[model samples]
Target: MGTDETTGAEPRATLEGFLRARRDRVRPEDVGLPGSGRRRVPGLRREEVAILAGVSTDYYMRLEQGRERNPSPQVLDALARALLLDGEATDHLHRLALAGGRRSRGAARPERVNPHLLRLLDRWSDTPAFVLGGTLDVVARNRLAAALHADFTVTDNLARMTFLDPAARGFHRDWDRSAAAVVAELHKAAGARADDPRLSALVGELSLRSTDFRTLWARHDVRGKSGGAKRLHHSAVGPLDLHYESFTVNNADGHGQQLVVYQAEPGSPSEEALALLGSLHTLYPENGPEAGAGTRTGRA
Candidate 1:
């Protein structure tokens, strides 16, 4: 999403943007609207969306134009259905509508990692584990986890590394999928803590630096924490396949802090790779080398 030329600032993400983006992605044929020839807009027309949502054309148009901020729950539900929004997308729509069309841009309190959690991460010698802050900032990481993500110039911020770091594109075997996932997670975080200045700044920086980030951010996809397998190519250990599980730390000093742990199956090649990574990690600590060293400070 580009900025308003008049303002010379990135347009604040609004409910209107969300609606327009989603609407642009849907087609008339997909929603049972009769195909039209040479339409000016990309997706279904505003009138078609209004019809599908059982609302007046003027009312729906107002919603998209930002003339109307809040929409009733019934209207939102109808719009969600009309747009064929998935559970995550539908939830995000509700959040945006209830938020009065704009993400909170207020300053947020600082986050601190719990010492006990750090100790726990340390105890997981074989497994790769790290704690992430609200905006997916790497709050803390164990030795193995540090080694696992050693390729990136800055491992402190996952979103930054995924978009800004060239090594990240090659490090993540499924580069496109990983990029989308990071943006979706960031969207979910923004919905919950939009007022956080750190999050806002991170979004602004990425929106400006990377066109890819802008394109994906405009998609408004929201995703929650869940375990999944990943394929990563490490320079030292070659390719490795591992599964990770994420756990939320409730009432932690940091908002939306999550603990992510990566593991490989026993007797597998990935397991051997993990062992090698651990051995190498002990010899070359994450903080020793300038090139491989990652920042401990919070960037978001």
Candidate 2:
């Protein structure tokens, strides 16, 4: 790769800094490596790391210095083991590798909302529901999600539109909780991909647009959003209270992608309200995606 000597802010430098910092924090005493003499550097040397990680000393040195950014999965795994990384830290290593300004292998396609999943969504056509990705992208939605959150997809990103969209101002009954959830999810994603360009780009956009997102991001909250509830205001359907559940379908093909679905409690007013919404979908099937047809996704 040709070096752009004039570029002052390089992403690899940030990745290099992270790698070196992680290297410096641990000593030979920590992982049973031999420390023969008093060390001059703060952390293990290039050769020490290489030995522990089962890599060539020269290659390890090049990686730490940001000269070789594309380390294979096996190599990364070995390095993580050598570094004694926990689960979260290991995930962060991948994120850092992706974010280190290196183009990664293309991501698997956005999951298709399968017929079974769509049928499940269809079963609750009255419920205000949608599916969200880890990055807060609106992957799928029922009619109610669209009616209540009209500008949600048009704004391109869920987190951005949630905090910055004018429609969202009154749509979400609880802004603080909603904001926290979004930021928390972002925090968790960032840890996994400290170097992901797309994620970094989204965070940068949110930081510029919404102070609330920036503040929450600084808190370093990690959230694996399995489920939650929200009260929504729809111009057509009025107000409806609903609870949602998220399931991460095991995409053997993809890294970490999840599909979220929502439901209303049985026998409650929301449930009754949801029933009414289901009726509308059956009668007015032409309103949603594929015009009364639902997309199926995942094995579930």
Candidate 3:
């Protein structure tokens, strides 16, 4: 019942919040349960979920109220099945259950990109690559990556850029999909780091500023960053269809870092545009069209 210092608001318990939001998404028909006409709430009732999970209604109610902690693996599995969660969402549910009300003790150390990774990024002159910290902060980027994101006013955090920057709507061709994916990634991060102050602050800022962010966040979607195709409209290069692969950087310190690289199909128009962009970057290293125009400092 403690208040969140970061947001100065009463914070919802992680497990309870997740359970409620997810429960609201599942319809009675989703689990082969016949519809009981005219329910006040969306999705299945607590009794319905308990029935599906093979647990007592009281126990399930306690679980949703944050009074019941330390659910066994068997119970967790049953709940996952009852909720019809996918692999990622199931894993996230387990993580939240295992967290056991942990809280952040102090400020986290600033994230730094590995020197070898930086060298690798620089070597891929034709590709766009960048390193992202746990909270999707762009810790480091190669010249090509910088050029790829030249339209962004703040290139620090992907979530911030997607939700807070005006250029994002134009830059991301599928704005709705991009926005949902960004929020879903953040949702996954929040499950792992429930009490992380920086993350809480970021979520609070986005929730306050963007209606779209609030709507997506409320869905409680969980997804990790992985290989995917992106359709982007660059200010200089027009539309560019690219595939990106994300690799985890296994640092000695065990910090969460991901190296993301973007590539275009060979002989495609996107590839030609990318090559043109690289040439432009090389021609004007500091003050050319590739330069990050209207760049501004962002929150760490």
Candidate 4:
């Protein structure tokens, strides 16, 4: 992501900041522009971007300055191409442009998990499953999911755990890659929930407290919940390799939640590890990793 002076600014200001940040990240050579040693600013200049995007420099400047709030879809598509944005980044750009309409109406209400969804999680005792809210908060989880993530003192927020928790380095076998991915996903979520106060507070806290998180956040990377593989080192069960699938939970409530389920190969060592973890969960139902931890409610 590109950087601009958007802290505490409204949706329009945030839109500006994102554009500047992304523009700063693109080098002259990156977009086939000649690298001039006499350049004064980092990344491509505003004129350069305007030229590439096939728009007037003044018009493009207005977009970043918040003088122009809406651009035609064709113009936006051109800007996206000029910026070399991927699918996720392009989607985020569109959301920011539209967020102004929603942000002015009112803040969004907090999200809650469905009771039926909770019951479904309980029934999947063999599989580790959890639900994540917009802020990547652990809103709901099965016993196995709790056990899988029990090593962390705070299982409520995944982003905090990845950056602030010391155990995260060992827990995630590929810490750097996972950390980057988590940061990117948070960026994507924030774009969708631009007016959510909770999201703002979380971003602020992480930016102030963790240097690594601050660095990643500035990159303006955007990613959504998707299927992937993870290698984990559990405190009790040792090493385990698992694959995960993420599903969007769509219902009348419009919670916009993601259901993430983890599974291991049937005859693999990871499967054996999962069974052992399950047994421990059963034996120490009261003192286990997620013992008595109720589901999280409200906005992240």
Better of 2 and 4 by lDDT: 4
Task: Report residue 45 deviation for candidate 1 (angstroms).
Answer: 1.1
Per-residue lDDT tens digits for candidate 4, residues 1-300, read 223244422212256777888999889999998997898778889999999999999999998887787887788888899989998899888887877445354555656777777778888877888888778877777888878877876566789889878889999999999999998888888777777777777787677667788778877788897999999999999999999999998851554688899999999999999999988666422222222233443222
Model 1 Cα lDDT, one tens digit per residue, 1-300: 346453333434567877898899899999888777889888988999999999999999999987898799899999999999998888888877766656555665666666677667778889988877888878678788888888877676889989988899778999999899999898877666656677777888888778888888878778877899899999889999999899999867547888898989899999999999999877545322221122345333
lDDT: worst 10-residue window of model 3: 287-296
Q: What's the alpha carbon RMSD for model 2?
A: 8.4
> Please, what is the whole-model Cα lDDT of each candidate in the order they appear?
0.79, 0.62, 0.79, 0.78
For candidate 3, list the clashing residue pairs, or say none. none
**Which residue pairs clash in candidate 2?**
95-193, 99-195, 99-196, 113-295, 113-296, 113-297, 114-296, 114-297, 115-296, 126-278
| Top-TM-score structure, candidate number | 3
In candidate 2, clashing pairs total 10
Clashes of each: 0, 10, 0, 6
Tell me how far the alpha carbon of residue 299 in candidate 4 is from the true structure, in angstroms, after superposition: 14
Query: How many clashes in candidate 1?
Result: 0
Per-residue lDDT of model 3, residues 1-300, tens digit only: 444454443233277778888999999999998877889879989998999999999999998888987898889889889999999998888888876555555556666656676678778889988777777777777778888888888677899999999999999999999899988888888777776677777787787777788778878889999999999999999999999999989981444778889999999999999998998776423222211221224542
Give the poorly placed runs of model 4, Cα more than 4 Å off: 1-13, 283-300
Task: Kindly indicate the candidate among 1 and 3 with the higher TM-score.
Answer: 3
| Ranking 2 against 3 by lDDT, winner | 3
CA lDDT of 175 in candidate 2?
71
Candidates sorted by TM-score, descending order? 3, 1, 4, 2
